[model samples]
Target: MAKKKVSKTIDDINRKIKEGKVVVVTADEMVGIVKKNGAEKAAQEVDVVTTGTFSPMCSSGAFINFGHTKPGIKASRTWLNDVPAYAGLAAVDCYMGATEPREDDPLNGVHPGQFKYGGGHVLHDLIAGKKVELRATSYGTDCYPETQVKKKITLSDLPYAMMLNPRNAYQNYNCAINLTKKTIYTYMGILKPNGGNANYATAGELSPLFNDPYYRTIGLGTRIFLGGAKGHVIAPGTQHNPNAERHENGIPLTPSGTLMVSGDMKEMDPRWVVGVSMLGYGCSLAVGLGIPIPILDAEMAEYTGVSD
Candidate 1:
């Protein structure tokens, strides 16, 4: 069978956005709407659909530049609340990785570091208006005379704090199943033994890529709701698989188009961005994101109408 062709355009979507007539629906809400009103009527009435998900993504972190201290110090080593922050980029600039294990993790010997307080937790603390310890050391350069510095700082003290996540939302992913008799720990959360339970990722119909499965509306510059703040899709995320198998509606049935998203960490709320521990796996961040899919035409509405 021939592949289905999508026919929505940007200009048409923009017009709806301008007119304030866009219809937005969440994934959990789409199935009922489609069944009640039918795809045709639902599509014609809806101009935009809002999809959202809160999932743990490990490949996420933030880069922050704490303005130089008096006399300046080329920060060579740094730690935040005892969790190491990468300080090799430049003086006073550090990248706090989301999954960097806690140095003094109580569970170090028993399992992978509990990751109870990693970069993501630091970010959450910073966003919640809490103070954190900032420690750094330098080799004492002539240009930057200061060698060592230790101070308590808040997120407000930094001039720039940006979350540059390598990967965020996935277009679609598989449901994890464990074939072994024992429970398995994985990035997709815990899996039970031998069909005891199936863990599925994605927000079902309420996911951004699921709504625009073929990358029709989602691309560079598309505005998205990231980690409790407004963000944008900068590029295709790492391991983007656009050629995956698809359903009749063109939504890929396998892991597909992912997004490289970024936003100002300063504007984020602690509620939507959180640090999580996967028992035996490791630490990660559960990020919440929402995207508005514009229903540009009948075809676009039909796409939005898909459920389950």
Candidate 2:
């Protein structure tokens, strides 16, 4: 018996992309397709499988480089809309990380769970074309002699605003089920007491990594849909543990691989990249990410069949 062959290659797909003749389908659409025609024939017919996932990602943030101020202030401490940002980098460069609640939040003091504003909200506001307060303090140097500077700034005002998230779009994550007696609030959202409710954070069939279990089509510099704009896989996300227990279908049983993604914050839409404040869980950004998996061969077609 002869071994089956994969008729197409990555270069072939690139040529099809150039010719605007590449076939594409959503992960959901591919399910029906592969189910009807089977993966072998599906491979012959399809060129790509698209996937999407939207969930709260705590390990998300952006880096903003505000232009040097008059007289050059070496910003030692910075805040965006009153949310503290790490300003230990260059003169006016800072990294605003989500999850840090505002210093002047007056709700959580009385109600322990009323965290309304945070770094995520500030980023959201900035992207929404809202002018946010940018305040910074310097130690007053000879070359950069400015102690304090405050101004209202928009996302466009910054020289560079890079949406560099360290970790996002977790592959196969946990299904939270509380076995205790009482409502519990967590990053996965609220879980009622004693298995009264279950919360899971994933798109299941529409998830990207599930379709390419071995990361064959996904790697460094893979293109993705980030915040409704074009983004790229910069690196394997933090805590990317791909060596996990998987089912017979090659899907992980627990949290597995992740992706570090980046895109231009200025090009992102506020609707797709949202700021969320979870009950008793601080703040996070709900990012919308999508990936297009190339169907390179029959094996990849079988893998893109969405094993779980």
The per-candidate count of clashes, in order, stands at 3, 0
* Stretches of candidate 1 exceeding 4 Å from the true structure: 1-22, 36-40, 106-108
User: Which candidate number maximizes TM-score?
Assistant: 2
Clash count, candidate 2: 0
lDDT of 1 at 66: 84
| lDDT of each residue in 212-254, candidate 2, tens digit only | 8879989999989999889999999999999989988788888
lDDT for every model? 0.81, 0.89
Q: TM-scores of the models, in the given order?
A: 0.90, 0.96
Task: After the best TM-score superposition of candidate 1, give how far the Cα of residue 307 lies from its true spot, in angstroms.
Answer: 1.1
- Clashing pairs for model 2 are none
lDDT (Cα, tens digit) per residue for candidate 1, span 176-214: 889999887777777889978888887777777877777
Error of 1 at 196 (Å): 3.2
Task: Give the CA lDDT, 0 to 100, for residue 307 in model 2.
Answer: 36
